[model samples]
Target: MNTKLPKLEPITSEWMFKFINNYELQESLFKSYESPINIHSLDAFSRNIKEYQEILATYNFNSKIFFARKANKFQNLITAAVANGIGVDTASYEELKQCIDLQVSSDKLISTAAIKSRKLLELAIKNKVLLVIDNQDELDQVAQIAREYNIKAKIGIRISGFYYEGNKLLSRFGFDIDDIENLLQNYFTEANEHLFNIEGFHFHLDGYSTSQRGESIHQTLDLIENLNSSKTSFKFIDIGGGILMNYLRHQNEWNLFKTELQDAVLENREPLTYNNDGLGYTNRNGQIEGDLATYPYYNENSKASFLKEILDTTNDSSKAVYQRLEQLNIELRLEPGRSLLNQVGITAARVAHRKVDARGNHLIGLEMNMSQMKSSSADFLLDPFVSYNNPIKEAEPVEVYFTGAYCLERDILLKRKIELPQLPEIGDTIIFVNTAGYMMHFFETEAHLFKRAQNLSVLGRKEHYTFDDFKTE
Candidate 1:
């Protein structure tokens, strides 16, 4: 391992440690399932769910946690979520259909697709799953489908234009809160009541800000209060998920990385990332500019404590947000995709080849593609474990970049240059910890006719897991 590098070591689960340490098992699986493989554990996922449940219990508020299915496409995790007394939040027709096929109850399935299609609306109406209407067109389609089915389709109106800290949060989705009066007067008419059952108000924000969440809840609460009457009422507030989760083990490491990255971008030090790409920073005439585009991998408060911070936010009347929900008998609903999958999965791939680029940089090729382990972030910051297949000989330390199987020049697996005590031999396994959320399959593809990585759900201890314990995809 390179001790001189500003390292962001991962805070891994016991399952990850056990699995990565077992070279024999990893090698056997690689041989069986091909090079790159994704392994998941329900233990961490279930534990995360219980933590949220426990925290909500402390507030004495009726809460619902829906596992956002868009984060990962693993069906086993969806089934596991329903079994744990939670629900599934799907964003597409196939996701909703698969959940229903898995026999998830109507109350435990919700459709929050950004672009709702007629087929999706029909399925959601038939299954009675709550469909969050984004705009008037979508609401009209859903209403028409409900009328065709001769049933009241359960619905939640997605609200946007929430004011946070003096700025109106802009988003293309959802109806403007300023137009709520007009919306209620026109679209939500008495005739529409027979075609729609307004269950609640829903909103999804982009960034992670506790204050913004608090302000949104306060605003939504005001809307529900003003709109509630003999004719209509809301039972829940679905805050679509942006809950943060910590990945790195040390805050100082993340801090040092930022400083070093700025120095590298300013030409004060050697390149930290491959080609000194700066992740998201730019050298603007001897000054670094642009915000870091990666996820905040090191958080002091996350998961349950993160939720607690929002619930503890006080309204204008000095009542806590949770207290308001409790007094109003409102269900505080969240669709957390990444946080619930924290520490739940890892990606493993085999070393393919090694070479030196024209720029004199060392490159080690892996059997996996960049899309197999990628997200919207500029790069994944956690360091990976190299499971060497052979014994260590007298070797010198080397710093190299990991490359992927794609033919494109931008197919670098990890932007940061990794330092190792020695160069890995062919067939050595490189394991990326805590990748179950958006890293493993969010943007994966089958380009170049390369088969997609296989997924396996594992159970039991490292020493006790058998082939039979794996739920294959």
Candidate 2:
């Protein structure tokens, strides 16, 4: 399928309604969870995983995918990932402990975050986790901790990649590539028998730039070789992340929702009947008139296909570009944050209040907050899931602005102008689609005292259950 998006819907209708509708999965939040919510968006994590496995096949790269736990703080997400062959990335001691409690092997869990506490350090030393060292300070600290725990562990350097144009190129989390003081050379070079294990190198690019990622892997290998000086000890170079997911053909960019709330001033009107006899209805695009024989096909190809393509390109280019740094020598590592869990989760909340301002503006207040999501912008900032049960037809419509219950003026979620069947009631649930990525349900804003959104999971093919039962052991 074309990677580019089609004529976009104002909201994520494809995942919000189409996918859920076909599966016949019902949301249970309507009665118990909170008020004003009757059946909200359901499990996004479960839905995405089955799709991501397909994306992985696209690349033919079988690198272990360690799901970045910070992306979504859901235990069910961790459960789903552990169930798959993929691993988990935890930066904190508690998260690491949770990983162990969840039964993930120490080799599969890598400590990637730069900052760490004494407790976190102790666990890493005791558990023998793949500690990704950042700089001299961190490297020294790791050495001290390892000595204290006396564990013969593996270590990897967070190497800087110079792909970005300017000084922004040096990774904030990794050692400066220009700085020869990387752990391998400075700490382990003169040691009698490997002061540190010196596993390999790792680096992560922020956005979805393929060339930047390719160059990052290439540069990491170069940095590793230059530092080791023909005496390479380790066998892994973590590319870190950037495994794209396949979220069906229709719903690609879930965050592109835009809402125009300024003009929303809801006005109730009389209900009317539809012309079911094909009186005013017309198939302008022949959409309703097509048969399955002529309709375009749906591609369920695996996500691995894309990874393999990039991996092949990187591996192929490395031979001529950086001949000494073997391409197939080091084990490829990845921490797929969103790609592994994007389709497996969704967020559901209730609409609390609705009103029209003095200038004829319609407003909807939901119980969910924007900060709950790791994304900078609110859902529908690029695309929203608009309420389709609007009373006013498109030919004659009034726009509505959606907001959250918080006191701040920035609490708005959706600004898409649309006609609605009265503002969402105190009990109506508004679900956010495809929130299984970085937006998983753990941002219980302490600033606002917003309880962490309750996370739920679908067991096997039938049981729909809550996440509280699967807490840290």
Candidate 3:
């Protein structure tokens, strides 16, 4: 049977289209490389940082924006953060050391790793970077280190309130609400208050629910109010970043596609071959039930304006976050990872060849593998744009699945089949946009000696690009 696939349009800026469509630039970049390459725009990165700063400036209370360093491993991004005088949020020893070595001020760093080593704790204490305490054991370890060095451990207690779906706390990163009193009594005594310093509280969740974030802030505020008798002084409330990034332009189309996919799957349609059982749903008592792991590819609230909504949001009792922060005299600290890196980079690969599969589905093979673009998400839902060195006018549009050079049959670069305006030819470029976030390097690998994709910085009006190898290592 013939199946009609759902089409997704990516949300992009005009400059991105112009930059990718520049035939001369594409020719120069693809001249030497036979594989994939990641082209990052430093200008875009600067614009995103400035936007966040502008948003934070709108509030009367003191606020800080910390670029979550684990989002992308590119050193240039970290350098940009330091140059702009913004803070950097690191999670590993190497990430922390890299920022310090790059001359990022010690005060402008925060370590929030779930598991930190003794050496990392020592380095953090020595450099005066803020350490977000995860648990009591880790807190004790930090206290010991601080005592050994004759310094107070600068810390913020990470706490978890109620999570979504009325479920138990989803994150394993923070302290439970009930544990706060015991913690304060045990650690904030006259004897040990000199050993550790409680600066504030922090909480991070997986989803980008503004209401939930506001609730967390309220819960943290209540916790602080209860600790008024304790010697611990709180200064900031770090609602760790879960800002949403919009990848798809049309929400209605996205929903329509999901419905069509389910219908097609249940109807046992043919001719549409999907990797991994065609979207994977569960059936129980004639009812289809399963949580398909899909991203909010088309969110109404995006990185550009979500912060405004968050700050303006009111709790169920109608208390605004800005008002709460103003009343508490507490600073707002944010550690955005993917949201900050949105629209800052793209991944391009040269089409090695094209052919028809055994099931008559058209297939286009690229020199790169799924690892280059894979993140924690099950699949990247946005459709990749095609950039041609030489334009071709086809009588009919051709639909095909993009495959990779990996030996495994499961190595599909894009699980969703895409339709190209014309049949792709050798040396043509397949471009994935807005990938500067975790998608660029999180799950990247040098498997099969592919040497991994080289990262190039598009500098100065996109006129010149340079390969920055040292940033990755």
Candidate 4:
């Protein structure tokens, strides 16, 4: 309600926003498979996986794409990734068991939690997945387990580096570079040759900006060089994923398009005017909606280029001064949690109620909460549209703020002034765009007066959905 809703039409100019509307695309893909509902189109996930891999390889970095099972933990994604030969990274007992159930080979899975339960740790060890041990005590404990089992365990020592953002990373999750070096040279592997075979280094970071990752890798590169000179090992570097989705990048670059589309949503119209198969968005009033060109950003390079550029900077000898160690051959792995699921998904909810607040503000409370969506972070801006993709029946823009099912005022999802098609009726399904990542189901509890939302994944062109995967008990 902060900004007045504008005329709400697509930009009449050059490329800015290339909408990746995954929900509309999925409906069409799910047509081929019978239990299409049982499977979702992980095609986007597959696309990002390879694209990111090749980007790393461009910088002469070895690539191992590990799917962070924590993001969605959807069986469909797991099945598709395992079948595609992608490695899986699990953080819990259920995730571990899920791997077994999905028949994901133990070799393809890695157990990486800064802190884990004994049962979970033992379960991971028993399953033979690479265990990323955190903290000194756990390292000692893992060393003990390696000795007790008489099996040589492949390990990655996570290094807690300083944040380029200048925020102190005091989380008790990783070893300082000095500590990892000392343990590497003095104790860990020596304490139990049967157990700890530290193969690489891993670190988890926040968000998708590439500079942070490059900085961490830069430091890790130095660590690898010094450690290799002193000791004689190290092979992999796990840069935990927070890469920006292509659609997200599009929104940022095409700020003008998104701004207009943001206005159009409430007005119930197109974001572009298209002809000759180009993706249509905003246009003149009563403009024909067909023949819009496919919004092209990913293939031609938008955000991916930024990511690749960051990786490319490593070639600058001045930055990666550890040239000899760079030759040791290391596979760069990314555990992307968000980019993989872009647009291929949607969260549906019936409007719970409509009420007018003190300032004559109309508030539509949805059944689910906004905290579920990860991309809508402090910096995660959302340009959501009604995902139906059909022509809009209502044309007037509805200017209102949204509240969640929870009673707390802070439980709201969209804090910004969003433009939705005028006067959405109670019980009408509201779809939040680009929510396929962490938005669908991260913070669901049967707290307060609200009920949990149902999660469904779309498969091929049939637009079929698999429900009940996230139905609360």
Q: Write the per-residue lDDT of candidate 3 for residues 33-79, one digit (tens) a residue.
A: 54687867677777888988888887788998899988888888888
* Candidate 2: regions farther than 4 A off: 1-28, 35-62, 163-168, 181-183, 190-195, 225-229, 244-309, 312-327, 382-397, 415-423, 440-443, 460-473
- lDDT for each residue of candidate 2 in 24-75, tens digit (9 for 90 to 100): 1223343345422212222444455545555545443334567788867666
Scored by Cα lDDT, where does model 3 land? Answer: 0.79
Off by over 4 Å in 1: 1-3, 462-466
TM-score ranking, high to low: 1, 3, 4, 2
Worst 10 residues of 3 by lDDT: 464-473
Worst 10 residues of 2 by lDDT: 258-267
lDDT of 1 by residue, 246-268 (tens): 99999999999998888888888
**Looking at model 4, which ten-residue stretch has the lowest summed lDDT?**
10-19
Candidate 4: TM-score?
Answer: 0.73
Tell me the TM-score of model 3: 0.92
Using lDDT as the yardstick, the better of models 1 and 3 is 1
Q: Give per-model TM-scores.
A: 0.98, 0.73, 0.92, 0.73
| Model 4 residue 432 distance off true place after TM-score fit, in angstroms | 0.9
The TM-score leader among the candidates is: 1
| lDDT by residue for model 4 (1-473), tens | 32443322221101011112344433443333211121224555576667666665556546677788777746677876776668888878788888877778887888887567777666777777787877777777776676677766677878785556666455467787657667776775444555766788988875445666677777787788788775457888887776655544343345554445434533444322111111233345644343213223232333367566456555346655223235667767767666666554544454667888886667878656655543333312444544333436757776666677556766555544456776666544455555556656554455663444434443333332233222121
Question: What's the true lDDT of residue 413 in model 1?
Answer: 95
Index of the highest-lDDT prediction: 1
Q: Regarding lDDT, does 2 or 4 come out ahead?
A: 4
